[model samples]
Target: MAQDRALLRVEREEVLGYLLLDSATVKGDSVRYEGRNANSHNDVDAIRGIVRSQVLAQRMERDGIDPKRVAAFARFPLEMHTQRIDDKGRDRGVQLGLIFLGYAVALLLYMMIVIYGQAIMRSVLEEKTTRVAEVVVSSVNTDILLAGKILGVGLVAITQVLSWVVLSIAAMKYGAQYIFGEQVQAAAVATAAGSPGAGGSPGLGLLAVGLPPVPLWATVALFLCFVLGFIFYASLFAAVGAMVNSQEDVQQAATPVMLLLVSSVIFMGPIMANPGSAMARTMSMLPTSAPIIMPLRITLVPVPWIEVVGALAGVAAACAASIWLSGRIYRVGLLMYGKKPSLGELARWIKYAR
Candidate 1:
């Protein structure tokens, strides 16, 4: 009965017996066993099973019988070990930070494109509405006038963007410590070290959480994409402005372009989930969607250098083509303004402008 008892305390590779007999003497009924396991908790069952088998063999030997014949021989003993569940390469904080950065870049680009694009539209409309375009047309070529408007507004957008970036970086470096407090900062560091489930919630007040470092190359790529994207869409906005006679007609003219822009943003989630998917890759290559999708993909996956260069080339070509086509519409539409022209008349204007 004593040898059959399985539960025993393990100390320094020795098994201590829990049962005491009426004879006031201790017997070595429990068996000692060694196991190859990293975690002591996982070795508990293995140790107990192995020790029980050994104790039975010892009892058989003590009873003047062959222990090997009487004892159970396992062809394959069951072993259990805990495998590491977390991927060391997958840093959640860094991943989240990269995603947030990409989202911020995409958002800022969208806002700037829409804001400055509309500004160009309104500027063109104001000049045409006041008959200033007529006087200005004498001195400026229509292509050059349109190009100048895009360039001027584009420069202002660039300035505002740079100022915001500088301020944001400065705030992250200098102001975060003062705002978040030392305790929250410590908690942030502790959480990032992989004990997130062990304790209290860090909450949204952890301002000192470390963000993944933004690669310099990504910044350069983002800037180039923003410029090219702005020019491409701004050309269309200018064309829309020329087509419409008044602000009331602007919404109707601008809806298609705005919808296209909005759709690119809407596809952001799918792009992030499967950056290597065909749909994401195709969208990243397109000039209209590339600006938003490519940046988001960059933060999450490795985009080939050739793809980046190819997308840029595609966007540049599209921008040039847009400027040419829009310039034609803008030239003819700016002067004739009693009512908005139909699609047939706009097509005629394009041929005549050529």
Candidate 2:
């Protein structure tokens, strides 16, 4: 029994020695091994390589452990530390600009889609009811006619958004003195204390506020995303308008789509409030919800580069899918003139193109 106990202890010690060389599970003493057999050799080789590269001789002479090894284990790599600083700076800037731009762009998009979408619906109904659509259809292909109308109206909507953005920026710049009087005064006071005559100097406070600034790049990216998102939704709206013969019918069809947009927007608010939340992460990846969610995410969260790339890719794919679906509906709904189609008929439209 004593001999058996001694043999088991020896075996355990040998096992421990082998495992101590394993990079994955080399931490202190361990009871259970938890690594794959496949990469064990490679991991061991890597650990050996790291140990070899470490200047242990210099470490013994200088600080007992090589400064490089100490840094490697105790502190982040210099490149990584620099990158972290850069990232923090970027995140701070993004946080400031994102809040301002997200709200502004969201409000503008909501207004434009609602207003111009209604116009498209009304125009479609009027054209069809007055038999004007029939005349136009005779002269031009339905597809071309529909594309032209959507493009023309979309261009107008784009113009309105641009105008609003410009006017809003101008108003904020000129009206800051009136709107934020106390804050500006406090800033000026702080500035004067630091540099006595700096107060009376022209553009001193303005310089303090930061010039050639205002997150223009972030705003541009947000606007481009908004435009793409709008195109995706508006195309569906146009199709729905084509399907319905009258204003009342269009309203019924438009309700679902509008509700979806509203729900996406509402969902965006929560995501903005906690951009790092799991729900926000999931929603941002979804193409249908991404347009609304991504901007909000940019505002509240530090979205990883990979996530941004993946989300944009998903949005592009979804846009392609939406376009395909919209084309089918547009093609079928353009020729139909009577009662509105049922859900079943819509299903048939999917197969119409197929």
CA RMSD of all predictions: 16.0, 16.8
* Candidate 1 Cα misplacement greater than 4 A, ranges: 1-93, 195-206
Backbone clash numbers for all candidates listed: 0, 0
lDDT of 1 by residue, 314-341 (tens): 8999998999899999999889888888
User: Using Cα atoms with residue i matched to residue i, what is each candidate's TM-score against the true structure?
Assistant: 0.71, 0.64
Per-residue alpha-carbon lDDT of candidate 2 for residues 48-140, written as tens digits (9 for 90 to 100): 445433433334446665655665544322110000011222222212234555555565666677778778767776787787877887788
Clash pairs (backbone) in predicted model 2: none
- Among these predictions, the greatest lDDT belongs to 1
Candidate 1 matches the true fold with a TM-score of 0.71
**After superposition, candidate 2 runs with Cα above 4 Å error:** 1-98, 178-183, 187-217
lDDT of 1: 0.70
